[model samples]
Target: MYQVRVLVLCGAHPLYTNWTAPRSTFTSLLPRAKDRHWSLLLHQGLPLNNMAIFAKAPTTCVSFLLPGPVIIQTDEASSEVLYPNYQNCWSLREKTRGRKKAAILQPGISKDLEKVKAGVGINSSDEVDFFVLLDNVAAEQVHSLLSCPALKRFAQMIEQRAVDTALYMLQEEDREGIQMAVGPFLHLLEGNLLKAADPTTPSGKTRKLYLYATHDVTLMPILMALGIFDHKWPPFAADLTMELYQHQESKEWFVQLYYHGEEQVPRGCPDKLCPLDKFLNTMSLYAVSPEKYHMLCSQAQTMELGE
Candidate 1:
């Protein structure tokens, strides 16, 4: 059987990190997987300043490209409307134009989570063929605006966008034989991983499987939601990483988590512009091993924050 090395890239920002450590690491790593097909999976967080670099290399064997960063504004009035019950106000506004929403909604968190559970075909006895990846940011602070009542109305809109993006890629004809990669909120990562990792189902039969959670500091709450950590702990102040690698011959996947150095970018994208090639080359050399990369994603459902 042929092995495909899929690289899922996401983090605080790429351009401003000096482009040497992580970049060089990744470059060296990709070529090492000799005899295997090398596929690059670009998640969210690529900077707007670096858009030119990505656009210039359209045919560079990229298996998937998610919509870039988006900004959400929470004005006082909007916040009041969205989080009326909490004695605090919250608002949700798009930071970037033409960006898409994240996931489909189902009334309440329980209901929405139920829908996600169903998507993984959890109840089915047969193995559903797919892998999962979750890209998110870590929210450093909990704003009263996050609890706004008005924001709830748009919940479904956000959920639909995220789900649609994954489903769309899954439906592509060329993707049939390849292992699946599912990206969801960090809070949802543990559950998704458990579901996808279940050994009883047919979906778990794939020889090689992977589930990636990509994000920056905004991943805190979702991690809390997943019970991975607690709110009292400072939000994931540094870059955190995790990996799940399946041994094709054994069908057993090894999972590990790592903490990379702290990144100081505010919105996730880099403050400066760097050529895409330079960045990719850097990634090739600096990419972390499954056991040592940090994860800094969030569970925000809106496009603005989702990216």
Candidate 2:
């Protein structure tokens, strides 16, 4: 029986850098934030931010990804016990998959900020700073601060504006934005899919599951590239899964996507599980080969140096 192959890609756990609070304030708030929420998610009483927490209980990252309460007993020391449910996983060292394109993408955000300033009721730089502070707080703890209906509405507006600005620069405003942000990931994903479809080829080693640990920067772009981004800030430990299925009789491969847990239909595909060819065609708009990626990065760097 040939079981369906699955690819699970997800962002990392909450990190110090994920917070937008000032450095001085962050020193205090980080601990409080952890004490309030993150403490419950800890594994075996281990401290928050412990890298070994994931190593010991891989499924403790978040609620949706948690298959069950993985109990790792120190007495039963085995690889299977430590890392359950998966056989093979690879970590791409170059975590900044599209760092070169980030510069090209950043300039458009100023335009996004300009577009939203009026809507946000910000007339001055100080007001802009206030708006940002409020937005960050709302994102982290909306219910805690925003108790009044009017205040909650304002907070929602601020949060929406922030989310929209990020999404606009990533996908909504221009096609190139999506292309630049997702090109590297698309290239890797397409190559992997193609290889997994073939069995005879030397490089085509079939693996039942593939997991990619990444950050929101990588997750948002891939989602936007696939035309399924929900336009909200991706939460910590958010996952996007791509499942490849082979028909029992015909043996043709098909692709289906899930974000967090909800099934998603790709941009132009008719249904949830789309034919691999059509899926590749939809992805072709953003895939950047290594050679093209290098050339673009070089050009960008040269232009920046010249300027």
Candidate 3:
């Protein structure tokens, strides 16, 4: 059996689900393209050939969600419409077309949060906005935990139930919320993305920092796949990071993962950092494709029907 570095044995990944192509078919040596930023390692069916792809491939990947999006989802605003002037308020951080945003929200909305603490609600304890209040309370509790000496242990205990529940829901073959969201995200790391760890040729190179702003719907599955999530749901503002490092002498790659600035150990690596080649070999199976993830998801429904 092929061993995975971090993920539990759920099943084959989307790319490997129905792949029957003979390994020998792709044996030709194809020259690298000059213009593109990243090339698939398996391009032209050859082995790892390019430096750019090797650079951007992060050794780490995982998930964690925040209260803001969760509150938005659960606050009966399924449509995702925000307050009138707030529609275009948030910025994408990255600038394009030589233009920058007016301003971007910091890691957490400390200023806005202070406003809430001052009673933006109809009343300090209104039930109509009670759910949002619950969110604020939970956020404050986590903030308090940061300074407590036993913060790590307390945080773990708090998150165990969330981790268990996320894992349980994702394991259900028929359920798509967590499972479907998970596969593509992992593929973005292992299957397609290139690493910037290795020094590149003189001109064309990929950037070292790749930043994405997304909600918790995308975070939980990744956490489950990595088997490293343990927290009482993501708080007001959370960060899940997958950092890659390269050895100066050996040229070997390593993956270090972090959540909200706290380092996490993936199950695959005993010391909590996975070897790059080993990590990719294990995760390659789950790499992206059109329909395989949904197909894998059907394993649940099929079992229930006994067909």
User: Model 2 over residues 142-245: C-alpha lDDT tens digits?
Assistant: 12322334334455455455565555444454454454445666777888788888767575366545545455556666777788878776663355778889
lDDT tens digits, residue span 61-147, model 1 = 224322443343435531221111112101111211111122222244335444444553344343221112121111111211133
Please write out the lDDT profile of model 3 over residues 150-187, one tens digit for every residue.
Answer: 32323443344333433443442323333344454566
Task: TM-score for candidate 1, please give it.
Answer: 0.25
- The per-model lDDT (C-alpha) reads 0.29, 0.51, 0.40
Q: How big is the positional error of residue 70 in model 1, measured in Å on the Cα after superposition? A: 23
**Candidates ranked, most accurate by TM-score first:** 2, 3, 1
Worst ten in a row by lDDT for model 3: 92-101
| Least accurate 10 contiguous residues by lDDT in model 1 | 89-98
Task: Give the top-scoring candidate (TM-score).
Answer: 2
lDDT of 1 at 86: 17
